[model samples]
Target: MTGSSRRDFLRDSAVIGAASLLAPATMVASTTSDGAPDVPGATAATTGLTPHPGPLHEVAQDEAYWKKVADQYRVTNAVTNLEAGYWGLMSQPVLAKYHEHIDRMNRENSYFARREFPALWRSARERVAQFVGAKPSEIALSRGATEALQALISQYNKVGAGDTVMYADLDYNAMQWAMNGLAKSVGAKVATLDIPEPATHANILEAYTRALDANPRTKLLLLTHCNNKTGLLLPVKDVATLARSRGVDVVVDAAHSFGQIPLSMDALGADFVGINLHKWIGAPVGAGAMYIREGRLDAIDLAHADESAPPTRIDSRLHTGTVNFATMMTIPDAIDFQQSIGIPQKGARLRFLRDRWVKAVRDVPGVDVLTPDDADLAGAITSFRLHGRGTSQANAAIARTLLEEFGLFTFQRNGIAKGDCVRVTPTLYNTPADADKLASAIKTIAARG
Candidate 1:
């Protein structure tokens, strides 16, 4: 499609809101009986677009470049979407790859699954390992972070009777549950604490120190690198080192941090970690991987003692029966798409989008921005609570009002120690104008109260 034609389509989409136009002009409609659309934007092989040659932060400020980046995704005009925490949308290139893999899997069936898929699966694991700076033997793919985390938590054999497994209030809900179950199964105790509000690096460290001192028997610490609750970025390395000093093993949850920020197993200094490729990596849903630092495999028991793989191999720790093969195969495409834009550039742009709205609403009357302004502590996902409204019902209603009244989509998050709040997460497809609209919407909502 011509550039002018594409512009016209997008312009008309604002009024029409047709489902068909949701796919950008760059997208190729499906022509096959199976109805798989062609890959959009630049194909994985040809996506050599450098985005911008300037410094990373300068590249983030280049709106024209970001607009081009935004065109790579298919976005709907139905509402301004600010909730990207659930799962990421695959770019056209990645989606096309997924469809291709799906079609191949269906056509070849057992021939591909038994003979060919094993090698491809190994390559996918290697790709994920390289992405996270780990060895192939240390990485094992799972359906999502939750699966990997559950395996890690449930299989943890360190804590015995009278010992303790600890998790914070800000950790993912499933991980917390797994910790509780692990403690119960091992005849251990569960230790819980709340992450401090207005969390700064020093204060957060202090909080963990206090928690560790209070629960000396805490043998396992479930530390979230980037919290799902309010997008609070934790200093994992520091916390992990402290835990180690106290003879505690740390199981880091990098589910939300994997592709959104710079992540490396070495940097995190955690022996066990779980990450999701589908969240910020732009891979299809059901793509995640777990990391067990070399020599720590014995800490986690083999999945049901099935003896499928060697006990030394990390895959032995997970026994996911049958996974979405197509989703796993498309991970390389998603990684390539993200790399084409560069991680530093992507992280900066997301924080820029976050700052655009937050700076506008931070001081607005009755509006409480939950995330700290420090770049080290915050990212694209930030939650806010209207003053005097802390209940789950109130926060959910605020989210509903945003969508119903302002056509802005967001999510209400509970389990925050202080109170429930509405989370706002802006993705790659969102523009500065969308952030402004969110700021305006929140201000209007606050005025109503």
Candidate 2:
């Protein structure tokens, strides 16, 4: 592939990232051939709630209206779901669009895969990159954050014999595997540490300071912007700057942050990162992205090559096998749904839900909430252990009790080095009533103890 072919591939692929085909919140549009007005609409197609025109945080406070918004999903009456930290189920409107894309894929098959799928995949990549203030050339599509993480961590080349690579116990388990593998590939030493229990913003930074200071030869650091196990939000920008000053390159795992928290590439200050669109962006199960800052591309090798995609191109690093054409094509609907709701509002709603539940049971004897008080150090995702029980079986049993006794579907997060706990994450769809029910379940369990 020549330079023109590369440009064509990029140009064609860039169009698929549309959050919605209806209109855009950020882009100015030109009139159609029929002279129709090109302004964006305020109303969400699924929920019918026109996001109130004002500061996003203020709009987030209107719960009466947000309840109506939750009605947009084909949710169940089975249980009050508090496990939204994983895949964010699609809204009915988005699901309808997704089904349509699936039908189109089935109908078109090879024709679409050959001529249209690559561009759609690129579009999905571009939209994800745009949401984070990145360039199309710097983004790659993946099945989920795990694959993106493996590519970035495994391919990291700056570390050499005796140089150290550092990561915390809270980092995603799959990424931990990649970092451990990196030790063999680059002949680098692995330095692992733990986040202090009952972590505060200052204490979290202090922990990183000690780790970097103790490992003077550490050249690569793996930072989890938000960890899956505890849902603890680390001060990545501060830590990344700290690492930079120590001459260490940082790779971030933001698998749980992008849509649940307000951020951009510049906000986190990481040169390389892997993000999950499926988690908070509400894309389908297999959608996620990887980002490599332009100047830092050479720090990691491509997992696979595109004769057409240059080494500097981020997508070149993602040697994703035969792509899921249907799943990739429907990503725009998720992006559109997120944009319709407003990112700031989505973040505020999640944090609001988290606080409501954690506050409800925080002071209860024998109940412990693991999230920090500082807003920056926590968000919608929070975890807790009963009687400080940290074993995998203990946490799993607690989750089972929540379900069997109280009809609450929550998660048992078992990977924290400090201990195990149950993670409860509330999304835009969850109501305050849902939070109250979860709190009541915790109280009931604690009262028995």
What TM-score goes with each of the models? 0.91, 0.89
lDDT by residue (1-449, candidate 1, tens digit) is 23332223212133322221012233333322332224333354443345467887788889988876776777778998899999999977677778788988999986766556666676678788889999988998899899999999999988999998899999999899999999999899998889888789999999999999999999999999988889999999999999999999999999999789776889899999999999999999999999999989989998887455656667668877766778877887788778878778889999999999999999999999989999889988999999858899999999999999999999999898899999999988899999999999999989888
Candidate 1 vs. true structure, TM-score: 0.91
List RMSD in Å for every model shown.
10.7, 5.9
List, in order, the clash count of every candidate structure: 0, 4
Candidate 1: regions farther than 4 A off: 1-42
Provide the lDDT at 153 for model 1: 94
Candidate-wise lDDT, in order: 0.84, 0.80
For model 2, the superposed segments whose C-alpha errors exceed 4 Å read 1-47, 54-58, 304-308
Q: Clashes in model 1: which pairs?
A: none
